[model samples]
Target: MLEEQLLQRSENKCELCQSGETLKLYAVPPQSANNVDNCIIVCDTCLSQIEKNKETEKNHWRCLTTSMWSELAAVQVVSWRMLNRLSTEGWAVDNLDMMYLDDETLAWAKAAAEDENDEIIEIHKDCNGSPLLAGDSIVLTKSLDVKGSTLNAKLGTVVKNIRLVENNTDQIEGKIEGQVIVILTKYVRKQG
Candidate 1:
């Protein structure tokens, strides 16, 4: 399978940070086919930051200083993109200055950049500022009074398998007392 090939290519380590934990295949953007040339193996941390599921940590990405020199075009393109994303940092800028990409690979990297610029991503977050995803469990930070119902959604209540409201980052849906209700995201905290 494709995953086996990527793991072999990456030596069972994350192609970005060389972390050998929870590795997964990541398809480089702007490419339609899933192949070794367009995909790289990355760890959960790298994958989370890459997909914007978590905030980017500058210290963690210092690995790009070495990964940018990879012979594979996919790894090079990803390193280039991450450098550009973190260009505000002096270290990232320095790395970008030294990194080079071929014309076609540069074009591919820029294509994803343009698409990123054109899209507006809405991420739902908990009261503690942690990103919330569908099927995540949350704890009520404040008690809520259900209108026209006797459901007691008290503080410290645990709501499991919550769903993010479509087109609305400020709200999520969860069941309480056998009834589903929309809860404001600010009143909840994501549970581990």
Candidate 2:
């Protein structure tokens, strides 16, 4: 439904240049949100150009000075996003102070831009260079001084039943001397 509305608003045209070749929705700068207000119909050419000249954010968004002054929410949001990305430039930084949005609308724009910072599942790599899976026993090849506690994990110590960190791809959770902590997978080797 949002896609359909976007198509209708842009009149099946690329909202940026009024071009009609294969209209697509562009979410300004932050790509996490893909929707009507946060997105505008664009074409493949514009998308690739944006990616190619990513280092030149100022020139890429020179079009926004005119586009930013528009009343459309999509336009405003796109302008806001682009300007924010280009905020490093002097002109874009000045525009941030000039740009104004009501509380409700500004809130919507921000909510749509919140990128997901989720946890990733991680496994121990190992001191011997082996991937440690869950339920596998491992031995610490090197001595480690546990921080913030008085647990001394000695070298050649065997730690059993290692738990892989759910949010990190290169770590495991294991208890040593009644203390639980994160251990780098590369420092642990799988034990039979």
Candidate 3:
């Protein structure tokens, strides 16, 4: 199986930190298929941090200084990506400057990085800076007068199952007073 192959290739240790505890396979992002070239063995700590399931420990990633030079393209790509994520640190910046990747590997790393950045940039937030998703309930923080009509959307109004306006982060659509109206995001707060 792929797990066995990865264990053998990684020498039964985490490829990034060389840890022998609780190791498992980690498929690199923007993955097209599962294979030795697209996966690496990682410990629970590394996996959790990489997946953002746990807080990142900057010192724990210092192992990248050595792993960045692995012969495997998968390892190199992950190392490069991690270094970029920790680029604010002087050591990580130095390591990134020293790391090298072939044209194809560099492209793969950049493609996945860009996808992550795009997702971060597209999130919609409410007046209090809380992230808003489709079908979420929100409360109007300020009363708004509907244009071209007599709709009075009063303050502290609860709008349920709101739909985010497509391609527009500044607005959401909700039914207030039995009429569907576009609401400004800055005037709403996400409801628990």
Q: Candidate 2 residues 1-192, lDDT tens each?
A: 777898898788766556678766666545465766567777665565544443443565777777777777767765665566555465765676578877865665565555422111222357654555677788887788888887888887788878878767578878888788777776777786
Count clashes in each candidate, considering only residues at least 3 apart in sequence or on different chains. 0, 11, 0
User: lDDT of all the models against the reference?
Assistant: 0.89, 0.67, 0.88
Q: Candidates 2 and 3: which is better by lDDT?
A: 3
lDDT of 1 at 97: 63
Residue-level lDDT tens digits of model 3 in 60-107? 999999999999998998888888777656687668767889999999
Model 2 root-mean-square deviation: 14.4
Among all candidates shown, the one with the greatest lDDT:
1
Model 1, residue pairs in steric clash: none
CA displacement after TM-score superposition, residue 115 of candidate 1 (Å): 1.3
Give me the runs in candidate 1 sitting further than 4 Å from their true place.
118-192
Instruction: Give the worst 10-residue stretch by lDDT in candidate 1.
Output: 116-125
Please provide TM-scores, in order, for all candidate models, with all chains considered together. 0.61, 0.44, 0.61
Clashing residue pairs in candidate 3 (N, C-alpha, C atoms within 3 angstroms)? none
**Which wins on TM-score, candidate 1 or candidate 2?**
1
